[model samples]
Structures are given as structure tokens and as C-alpha cells.
Target chain A: MSEELNVSCARPIGSEVDQGIDDSFVIEGAEASKAKKEETTMIMVGRKAPDFSAPGYHDGKFVNVKLSDFQGKWVVLCFYPGDFTFV
Target chain B: MSVDSMFVHKMWDEEELSKMVDGGIPFPMLSDAGGRVGTLYGVYDNEAGVETRGRFIIDPDGVIQGYEVLTPPVGRNVAESLRQLQAFQLIRAKKGAEATPSGWKPGKATLRPGPDLVGKVWEVWKVDQAFED
Candidate 1:
């Protein structure tokens, strides 16, 4: 699969995502502006959770976690405010 | 998870979170640096350079089943999240044959959905049935 993300802003769908072999999205050139972003809606129920890969801390270890890593399991992503600080 | 760096997450886990929950956060504390992921989810506050509190329940299909995003001062309801998760699972298992009512809990009565049951839901599903289990 090509590493480049399509320009249209629509998410890719189907079996490519299920197997976790698909390339991650890389938005090149045009940056999505803040003004444009305000028009973007929150991800709704039944829509695909945008796939992401990032570093995470767990059990005294740091590992890179991808949303696809937990496919086929119910995942609850609880995003809280900064650690050690009250929100 | 927020815009904190990986090392900050380590410190928070070792210094603070461990004191609250046994052995620190039970699940991975992801570092969404710059609130990139948060931005995609519409929880990022660019002006503050931080991501607000948010919770998303994604089913096995990678589809979002439920989500809640909030600003500060309002605490998240863990019980409500669990209820939603259970309800989503039940509905998925039933393949749309049945539906859980308000405040539904596991083992509680499930309503069979159909045209005939549209207005008759009250007859088969009682308010008391939701609290039975």
C-alpha cells in the first residue's frame, strides 16, 4: 500500500484496516487549518476510530501502541488531562 | 492521555498515579504529544496546548460505539461508561434482535424490537425489569 494519505480527508475503509497491515496516514503539504478544523465534527458512534500510533507508558516500560494493536477487543481510550496535575 | 511527553508519563506513573491506584494506571497511559490524536477526536485545545478529558469506547470492529469529551470541573462517570460498553456488547451479540432500555444492566430484561413492539415496549419491558439484574 502507498504510504501517502489521500487528499480528500475521507478515511480509508475495509479489510486493509482490519489486518493492521495498512500504512498509517501521512497528510502531506497542506496543513489542516484551525478554522477548517472547527467545521470538522467529532467522531460519532459507528464511525471508524481514527487509527493512531504513539508512545505510551505502562508497567515501568515504554512502548509504541497503535490502535490497531488491539483489534477484535473492546478498547476504552480514556484521555485525561496532564498527569500529576488536576484538570 | 494528554499532550504530555513519554517521560512525563513515566514520572506521573511512578510518583503520583501509583499512589492512587495499585501499581499505577492499569492500562497504558498514551502520550498524545501536541494533542495530535486529540485533535482528530475534537478534544484538543490548541490555544492551551492541551487535550481535554475524553473517553471513547471502540468495539472490535474499530468502530466507535460511544464517546464523551468534557472540559475541566466535571468528573467522568466510570459506571456510565461500563453500562454503555455492556449495552453495546449485548446489542452486538443480539445482532439488532433486541435492545437495552434506559439504565439497562447485564442480565436485566432485553426488549425484542419489531414493528409490533413499537408502542407495546411498555407491556413486555417494565421499569422494574431494568433494575432486576
Candidate 2:
């Protein structure tokens, strides 16, 4: 990896989110509304899964797992309403 | 992930989920407090103050190949998830040389990619099955 490339903040191939040339996340008013509109639809197929890290429970143990840790492997990430309730 | 705390996840796994699944779901049940991660996945329900039920299948390269979202009352299908995973793995193994038909599962027919498959699928599915390797 070149120092210039690193400075540019370009993610490697097959992982392409957060790759703006300016490396800025701040959205202009109109773009914020457009981004919010995109968020509502949530059609995420054919896109990079967003990376995250959180405290988690697994096998009677509490641990922290980062979504990026599962990189280079298939993952089935599930989200439910709550722990106790079936809903 | 949901807005619930990790402590709540521990309680639910011990008190409820472990009984349902022998190993308590076999994966990390991450806490998404304040709907942070849930918001990223678009599963957080601001009106309801909770995250909705959803599942995402992500391939090795970090791409979101598929996802299913269900409301509070409805339940999602594990079989469908497994079928889709199998299909994705098969396609990857074949290097995209073959494709799975709708509702396709492991050990079933796989279609070859090309123009010849159009309108000839039903008869050709069996033909494709014969060529499976």
C-alpha cells in the first residue's frame, strides 16, 4: 500500500464504503434529506455490509465482536426486537 | 442486533434461548444500544423504540447479498435462509458458472448461465441436473 493511497483513505477492493476523496461524512442539507430517503428504503443487496462492533452474549459468556472480524467469511447477521420477547 | 443491552442478552440466552437452541443460537447476540447498529442496518424503528426483526446474508467480501425484514407479528423462515446460503455457496464454488432457480436448495438443479436457458428452463433444468458435477 502506498503512503499516498493510505493518505487518500481508499479502502481495498471488494470493500468500498467510506471512500470519499475528501473523507468527509458531513452531509449538506439537501444531501442529508436524500441520504435519509435512501435509508428508509433499505434495499441493501449488492452492497457492502456496514461494519460494527458491540458488546455481545455468546455461549453463556459476554464478549465483544466486531462485524469486520468476520471479514473473508460468510456471515448470517440477525437482528431481533428484543431478547426476552418473541417479537 | 437490537437496542437491548448485553446484560439483557445474557439473561435471555440463559433463561430462554438456550432451551430453544442447544448452544443458545450458536452466534454472538450483539447489543445495539441506542439503536446505533440497528440504524446502520435500517432495522431500527424510531416510532416503536426498538429494532425490527431482520436477517442479512453477507458474503466473504463483506457484501450484503440478501436480507429479510419482518414486522413484529410475523416470523421469518430459517429454511429459506439456509436455502439461500446454500445457493450462494454453490454459486461461489462454481465460480458463477451455474445459477440457482427460484426456491432452489442444495442437491437440486442448478442452471448454467447463458442465452440458451431462456424459455427452455423446465426441460433444460433436468438437462442441467444431468450435467451437475
Candidate 3:
């Protein structure tokens, strides 16, 4: 990772990010922004949930899992690059 | 704490994960096919067509209470997420609409509602009664 590419996460993507071990790079910049510039006036504290219906391989047959399906449950929605790897 | 699992799809075998269970990794894994959920969550690694590691703990009310999107090649803490869910439930039950302070833990003091209480919650056990006015 070069020094110029090691900018902090104060700015959004396309600014700069750390390089992965494989020489690959991923952005860790700000994913959200606020309307005001001051810290006290800023209010970007909530998460935005996504909606989709997709066929999941459940019970040996494909079933759909929609965002609304888990409406009443606390959803721990995670995303991983690939399974089986350490990450 | 009630928590559901959802993950982006990648080729993995259940048997391998089962063998590593006792090694400290906890929680069930779900698969998100075709990077759809990854794109939606803004954690998709576009060049690789897979999601970078990211975690979110949504409350039963469907509000996200704990979230972390790690840079690629970095794993997440499943146990930490579970702990967060428990704390979030306890706080939500006691505080309702008021927000939780950073690093909030169970049995700790919380900020009360109303303008008079602003900045009055100095610590977990030192809430000034005057702010209740």
C-alpha cells in the first residue's frame, strides 16, 4: 500500500483506499453523508435496508427470501466476498 | 436477542464450517446469489462479482442498530454482532425513542428524552436528577 493511496475515510469512494494483500484494493471511504458540515448538526446515524425477492436454495428447492419476509425479526444481513476463505 | 442470518452466496461446504465450529466461529451462514444483496448493501466488490465482508444488526423493528462494513480481506465479528443485538434490545426496551450512546452497554445509564436532558448524561451511574425537569 502506497502512502498516497492511504487516505483516511473522511471522504467518499474514488478518493483513496488501502490496498489488499493480493495487491488488490477496496475502498473504505464514507458510505454515508450528512447535510450539515458541523459535527453536532450532522445526523446520518440510521441504516438503509434493501428490498429484494430472490430464489434461495431452501429445503432442496428454491424459495424466495424477501426483505419483508423478515420484517418482525432482527435481521443480521451480511455480505462476504467468497465463502471458505478466511474472510 | 432475536437475530436472523443472511449472506451473499459463494461456493462453500457446510461440512468444513461444521468442523470449525468449536474453534470459536459462531452463527449460521446464509447465501446471497448473484451479488444482488451485496449490491443493495453497497458492499459488493464489483471487480470480483462478490461482496466484501460487511455486517449489520437490525432490530426487530427493522431498524439497524449495529453496522460495520469492513475493507476486503478482513473478516467480521459474529459474536460481537450478537452482543450488540442483546444490548440494543435492552436499551430499546428501556429508552424507547432516545438514541444509545457510543459504546453503550447493558445496565449502563442512558440519555433521557427532552431538551433539558441534553448533554446531562455524563456517565452510566451519574445521571443528574435536575435534567428530569
Candidate 4:
């Protein structure tokens, strides 16, 4: 890793949201306020998944698991340091 | 781990994982290739370059709907997370326009938008719109 990369903050990626306020009952202003707060630390939602493929050890074998294979099921892809031996 | 190798290798062996599964450990432990998945997910320690115990709940469509990242000494609650998953799945299944409230359980009340909705949220079936300010 570069030392220069370590000393700075990375800008958030994605589209900018408008926070302009026009009225009360219209409720667009309140929505902008909430969006602004969320924009600070919010992870991107409703986007295409990052493509990935891996060998998963299951049932005494290393089976190939890809993001595309799970087209119809909810896949909880979790990554940990090694294996959680203490937990 | 190198970026070219992320999610390519199983972090643990089958025997250890089998034991965890037999002990009622739910969810699959994806290998991050040395720790490549962790790095891309931002849960990886750049200095050490290993996963930092992060969990992500991806929807059926392959989108990461929700996630939680934790540092060492802090663990994730599987049961609670499962509940959240159930709520998410249920809400999605129903196609109701609402989000689950705190401690939301399946088959319970959900929230909707309206003036009198809050009063009867416990009786309705959506929780997203019933969130209290």
C-alpha cells in the first residue's frame, strides 16, 4: 500500500442528491434532510452486485460457488479473518 | 490477499466448518482468498490485509441489501440477524411498502403511511412507514 493513500480520506462514490426545500406538506425538504444524513455514511443500495467466484468447502469437497449461481436464492456472503475459532 | 485472488480460496477447511454447522451455526463461511473479499468489502485491514469479521446479507438478486462490520472483541448475533433476515424476506415477499421496526418478528404488525396508521400499526402488517420520529 502506498503511504500517500494512507494519509488521506477517500471520497464517497455515487450520485449527488438535491436538498432544496420548497414546502412543508410537499415533504420533499424533510426527505432531503434525511437523505443528506444518510448520504454521509450510507452504503450503496439497489445496485448490481460485484461479480465474484470462489471455491467453497462443503460436504467434504471444494465446490465452486459464484455470485451468478445464486440467481434465485438469497446468499449471505460473509468474510472473516480466518475462521472464527473463538466464537 | 491480492485483489486478483479475492474470494478464490476457502479461509477454513471442511472439517472445522462441518463442526460449526453441526453445532447449529447457520450461514455459509465464504472464503476471501487470503482476504480479498474483505478488502473489496472494506472490512479488510489494509495494513494486515485480512478480513475484519464482517457480515453481509445479499438479496436473491445479488444485491447487498444490508451489512454489518465489526472489529475484534465484538461479535455478531446470529439469532437477531436471522430475525432481521426473516423480516426482510417477509416484507419483500408481501411486496408491502414498509420497513420493519425494532424487534420486528414475522407474522406481526407492520407499518404504513397515514395519519391514523401509527395508532393501528400493531394491527397492520408493515413497519417501514410506522417508524416513530
* Model 4 lDDT, residue B90, Cα: 80
**Candidates 2 and 3, the one with greater lDDT:** 2
Kindly report which residue pairs in candidate 4 clash with one another: B99-B128, B110-B125, B110-B126, B110-B127, B111-B126, B111-B127
Q: Model 3 over residues B31-68: C-alpha lDDT tens digits? A: 45455456555566668766677777776665667678
Candidate closer to the true structure by TM-score (higher is better), 3 or 4: 4
Q: Which pairs clash (backbone N, Cα, C closer than 3 Å) in model 3?
A: B8-B32, B9-B32
Q: Which regions of candidate 1 fall more than 4 Å away from where they truly are?
A: A1-42, B126-133
- Per-residue accuracy of model 1 over B48-78 as CA lDDT, tens digit each: 8877878999999889988998885687989
Model 4 off-target regions past 4 Å? A1-43, B1-20, B23-29, B114-133
Residues A1-87 of candidate 4: C-alpha lDDT, one tens digit per residue: 001112124321112223343444443678876754543334455654555554443443334455666777886666555553454
Q: Where does candidate 2 chain B have its weakest 10-residue lDDT segment? A: B124-133
Q: Count the backbone clashes (under 3 Å) in each candidate.
A: 0, 1, 2, 6
The prediction achieving the highest lDDT against the true structure is 1
Better of 3 and 4 by lDDT: 4
Kindly give the stretch of ten consecutive residues in candidate 3 chain A with the minimal lDDT sum. Answer: A11-20
Candidate 3, residue B4: the lDDT equals 16
* Chain A accuracy as TM-score for every candidate: 0.51, 0.51, 0.39, 0.45
lDDT of 3: 0.49
lDDT of 2: 0.72
TM-score of each: 0.78, 0.78, 0.58, 0.62
Model 2 DockQ vs. reference? 0.37
Error of 2 at B87 (Å): 0.5
